[model samples]
Target: MTKLDITKTNRAIENLLETTENPRHRFMLQAYYRHRYLEIAGRYEEIFAPEMMVENPVYHFHALGLNVRLEGQDAIKNLYREWSETGECVMYADDEEVAVSDHMIASKLTGYQFKPGKVLAAVGIDVDDENAMYIYKASEEMVWPYDDRCRLVGEDVWEVDPDKAEIIKLDPADVITASDARTMLEPLIKPLPPYDEAAMRPRATAR
Candidate 1:
């Protein structure tokens, strides 16, 4: 894992936004910037958790303002019904018990709030309703790789595709700067420290 220079990356993005003119170009730039932003924010690694593997598979869905994680074949059946009935298929980790409504899925998934129609102005983006589109598009591009633990192991892993997983790749683009981003994003996205280290440390033995 490399460190990232979040400060420099953020400033550069701001600078690019300030000078860019064309809306289409600006949109692409913003997508790239936001992608880097999420990368710096460590959204990719946490969501993927490549180091860990899941054993028993379970599927969960959030819709109609309800959150449910189901076990066995029935889980998929319920998820399909929900999607067919409501046209909502946004899913999150079943282990976390996170409610879809509690946090904006875009922000949760991407690590940046997409406020449409509001321009930083300083960044030169119209940012109005287009912000929604930006986020949706970016989310579509972001990918994650689930370990053995994922319930839908054989299916498409939205978070792991190259187009979708570009954020993770950002770590290797620039060594020193990337490390900084990793350091910063790790706390925000994966605040909890690894338990294995603590569990493995030698305990004081009684004399």
Candidate 2:
């Protein structure tokens, strides 16, 4: 994956959100902002690996402040206990309106594709690209799973339940809408900052 200039992207997004008028345009801007957020959060496997819980105790997706706390043995015990009582894992969707299916939850546990629309709704937007057709088709890959209880397994592998994953496939019309939105609002989007020479300087070695 190519490295992204996050600071620049954030600035540009802020600018776009500030000046955009058309609803579609605003949506596309929000999409890019959401994309940047995920990129900084790291890949799904790295963030949700079970082993990470031992050291960090909690994996916090900073961009959105959504986190999963790992309580070691206590967590497993509680999960089993809850399952015994309720006959299901104790999981909740970010949006009450968006139901969490078994497949969705399992997918999250197994490091499968996670959709962002539900979480974005928490920040005040309702988006679903289920047809995999959006104007800015380039961003589809940036989306990742947002698990409430991600258990990491090994260095690069995770033990996610395929049942818990949510898929957001966008149709061709959706893509056109997204693109039209961006075009209408591009002028309002924020421009990136100029380069800083001092910050780019190499460190001096000790004599």
Q: Each candidate: what lDDT?
A: 0.31, 0.30
- The sequence of per-residue lDDT tens digits that candidate 1 reaches over residues 92-114 is 12111111111111112322211
Worst 10 residues of 2 by lDDT: 134-143
**TM-scores for candidates 1 onward, in order:** 0.23, 0.21
Model 2 agreement with the true structure over 17-88: per-residue lDDT tens digits: 677554333433343344323323332123222422233332222122233443444553453343323212
**Candidate 1 off by > 4 Å:** 1-5, 45-207
Cα lDDT of model 2 overall?
0.30
Where's the lowest-lDDT run of ten residues in candidate 1? 95-104
Clashes of 2: 42
Q: Name the best candidate (by TM-score).
A: 1
Q: Residue 177 in candidate 1 has what lDDT?
A: 30
